[model samples]
Target chain A: MENFTPGASFLGGVLIGLSASLLLLCNGKIAGISGILGGLLRPVRDDTLWRVFFIAGLLAGGAILRLVSPQVFDIALTRSGEVFLLAGLLVGFGARLGSGCTSGHGVCGISRLSPRSLLATLIFMTAGIVTVYIVNTFFGGAL
Target chain B: MSTLVTSFLAGMLFAVGLGLSGMTQPAKVVGFLDLTGRWDPSLACVMLGAIAVHAPAYRLIRRRSAPIFAAAFAIPTRRDFDLRLVGGAALFGIGWGLGGFCPGPAITSLPSGHTAVLLFVPAMVAGMYLHTLVEGLQVRRSGIVHPETVSRSPTLPPSPALQYRHDA
Candidate 1:
C-alpha cells in the first residue's frame, strides 16, 4: 500500500530493545527466541509450562495487537509457508549454535557491554545487511 | 520456567513492536538497511526507541544483587576484538545483505510465516553453530589464546525466583 515511515522502524527497534532490556533486568534472562524455542525442543519436566506459556503469550500478543491497531497491523507473510518453516528451523539451530539469538546478543548482550555480545551483534547485523543485498540484486525476488 | 516466562513476555512485546513497525516484511527491513542508496532512516527510530526506553530500566536492573533465576547474572565483559569477532561480522554482513533478515527480527517474525526469513534465519543459526564449532576446533588446534576465553570478574550470583516484574 503506502510506503512505511522510518518513525515506525525506529519506534519498533526501541520497543524491542526496551522489552529485551526489561526482561533481562528483571528476569536476568536474554530474550533470545532461539534459546527459548530450543529449550522447548528438549525441555525439562519443570520447564514445560513456562516455555509453553511464553510462546502462547507471544501469539496472543500479536493477535491482540492486530485487533488494537488494524491500520498498523498490515499483516503479510513475505514468503511461502514451506520457506517460512525451513527458516524457522535454521534460526532455531543458529540460535543454539551461536549461544544466543539477536535479542539475546544484539540487544541484551550489547547493552550489557558483553564483548561476546558486541561481536555477536556486529556479526548478526552484518549478516542481515549482506543478505538483503544478495537477495535484492542477484537472487531476484524468488529468494 | 521463570526464565522462559519472562522471555516469552519479552518476545510477545517484541512481536507486537515488529508488527506495528512493519518490520515483519523483508522489503521494510531491506529498505532500512539500504543506507548508501535510498537510505531509509526508519531503522534509526527503532534504535532510538530501544535506547530511550532501556536506559532507565537497565539502571534499575543492574542495581539488583542477582537475577531472578537460580544462580547469577550472565552479563559478559569481553572487551577485546579478535579474528572470531571480525570474521563473524563479515559472515553476518553477507547473510543480512543477501537474505534481509538477521537473528532477532527473523525469529520474531517467524509466526507470521515469511518465506525468505525462513531461509535466512536457519542459515543464520547454522552460521552461529558453525562459529562455535570452528572456535572450539581453533582453540584445540593452535592453543592461540583467544582474549575472550578469560573471565575478568565472577558473574553476579543467581537469585531465587522473585515476584512478577516489568520495566520499560
Candidate 2:
C-alpha cells in the first residue's frame, strides 16, 4: 500500500489510453508493445520502419524520464537475474502465442470488448497473481 | 512521415504513461500482482484509467470509415477460443508475475542501461523466436502446410478478419 499512488496511476493510465487511442485513431493500429516488437523480430518489409520509429520513441521517452525525474525510474527489481531471464522467456513466448500483453489484451483489446482479449487478460492476470503467491510465500521470494 | 510522427509520439506517450503509472518499477507491478501481500492497487487504477479512456475512444473511432493515416481499422477479428490464447496467456502471466516486466515497460527501459532490462529484453526476444521455432516444429510434425490457418499475419496492415496480435 505504501507504493500505491492512485492519482498518478490513474493519470498514467489515462495517458496510456490516450496513446493507444491515438495510435488506433491516426495510424489504424493497435498499440500492442509485444506485437510491435515481435513483428520487428521477424522483420517484415513494409512494417519495420514504423515499428523502429515507435520503438525509438519509447527509448527516447525512457531516456528523457531518466534525465528529468530519475526518482520515478527507480524501479526495484528484487528478483535474481535468473528469475528475470526465465520470466522474460515466458513473457516472450506467452505474448506471441497469446497475441498480446497488458497493452493489447488488457487495454486496447478490452476496450474493444474482444472476447479473446478478455480471456487473455483474465488468464495472464490470474497467472501473475498465482506466480506472485508462489514466489513470495512458497519460494520465500527467491524465485 | 505522418505515420512515423504519430507512431513515435504514441510510443513516447505510452512510455510516459508507464513511467507515471509506476509500471516501470518491478516492485510496483509485483505489488499489484501480490494479492496476498501488501497489495498496491496502482496497476489496477492504471488499467481502469486506460480502459475508461480507450473504450469510449474505440466507440467513437469505430464510427469512422477509415483512419487518417491508414485505409481502415487494423483490428483483430478472430472469434475462436483456442489453446494458444489461453495457454500463451497463462504462461505470460507467470513470466509477468515472476519478472515484473511486461514487454512494453521492458522495451521502454532498455535505454536506461539497467543490468536487469538488458538481460531480460534479449531473453524475451530469444523466447519469442523460440516459440516461433516450436510452433514451426509442431506444424511440421502435424504435416500441414497451413500454419496459423485461423489467424492472419499480425505484422501486416490489420484487416477486419485478421487475428488479434496480443502484445502488451
Candidate 3:
C-alpha cells in the first residue's frame, strides 16, 4: 500500500510483455524466469551460453536500475532465512514440476489462451493467497 | 550471435519490467497475493498489461515458419492438466506466498545484494536441480527409456517426462 504505483506497474507489465515477445519472436523461447534459470542448474552445453547471457542480462538490469533509480527496488523480506530457503526449494521444485510460474504461466501462457496455463495461474494464485492468509492470520505475518 | 544478443536483451528487458512493476519487492508481491488484507491490485495491472501485448504478439508471431536464430520454434506445445501440473503449481504457490519471490524476480533482485535473495537463489537452484535429478532417477526406476537429455542446452531444457506443458 505504501509503495503501490499502478501506473508504473502497468508500464512495467508492458515492458515484461515486450520482453517475452522479443524472445518468442527472435529466439523462439519463453521469458519464464524459473525455466530460464532452471536450465542452468542442469547445464546443457549448447543451451548453456544463451541462458548465461540472459541471466547476466538480468543481473545487469538490477545494476542499471540501481544506477538510475535505486528506489525502484525495495528488496526487503520479512521471512527468515530458513523460510526463504524452504520457499526457494519449493519454488524450484514446483516450477519445474508445474513447468511455469507467474511470468511464464500467468502472462505468456495465459495470453496464448492456453487452458493449461489458465489452470496453473488460478491454482498457484489461490495457493499463494491461502498461504498468505495462514501466515498473516496465524503465524504472526511470516512463517 | 543474434540468439545471444536477443536472449540477453530479452532478459534485461524482462528484469527491468519486474523491477519497475514492483514484483522485485517481496512485500509488494505479498501484498498482491494477500487478498483478504490490504490487498494491492497493482500486480493485476501488470498482468493485464503483459497479456494485452503478449497474447496478440504471440498470435501474430506464430505465422512465421521459424524464429530468426533457431532451426524451428523451440516452444512447448503440449496440452494437459495432469496431476504434476496441478500439484507443481500448488507447491509453487505455497513457495511464492511464503517467500514472495518467484524465480524471475528473485534472480533479478540479486544484484541489489539483499540477504534474503542471497540465501533464496542458491536454495532455489538446489531444489530445481535436485527435482530433476530425482525425477530422472524415478523415470529410470520405472523402466521408461532414458528421456531426451541432450537435445537442449544448459539453460532450462524441456522437461520431457514431468512437464510436457508448452512454454508459458
In terms of DockQ, the best-performing candidate is: 3
A55-125: candidate 2 lDDT, tens digit per residue:
88899899888887766656575778898899999999999999899999999989999898999999999
Report per-candidate TM-score of chain A alone. 0.76, 0.95, 0.91
Clash count list over all predictions? 37, 7, 8
Task: For all candidates, state DockQ relative to the true structure.
Answer: 0.33, 0.77, 0.79
lDDT of 3 by residue, A5-71 (tens): 8999999999999999998899888888888888776665577788888898988898888888777
| Candidate with more favorable, higher lDDT: 2 or 3 | 2
- For model 1, chain A alone compared with the true chain A gives a TM-score of 0.76
Weakest ten-residue segment in model 1 chain A by summed lDDT: A70-79
Least well predicted 10-residue stretch by lDDT in candidate 2 chain A: A39-48
Candidate 3 Cα deviation (angstroms), residue A70: 2.2
Clashing pairs in 2: A99-B165, A99-B166, A100-B166, A100-B167, A101-B166, A101-B167, A101-B168
Q: Which digits, one per residue and each the tens of the lDDT, describe model 2 over residues B1-168?
A: 898999999999999999999899888898999998999999999999999999999999989999999877778877678898999999999999999999999988887888889888999999899876776676668654431333355454533222333243
Instruction: Evaluate candidate 3 by giving its C-alpha RMSD to the native, one decimal.
Output: 3.5
lDDT, residue A14, model 2? 100
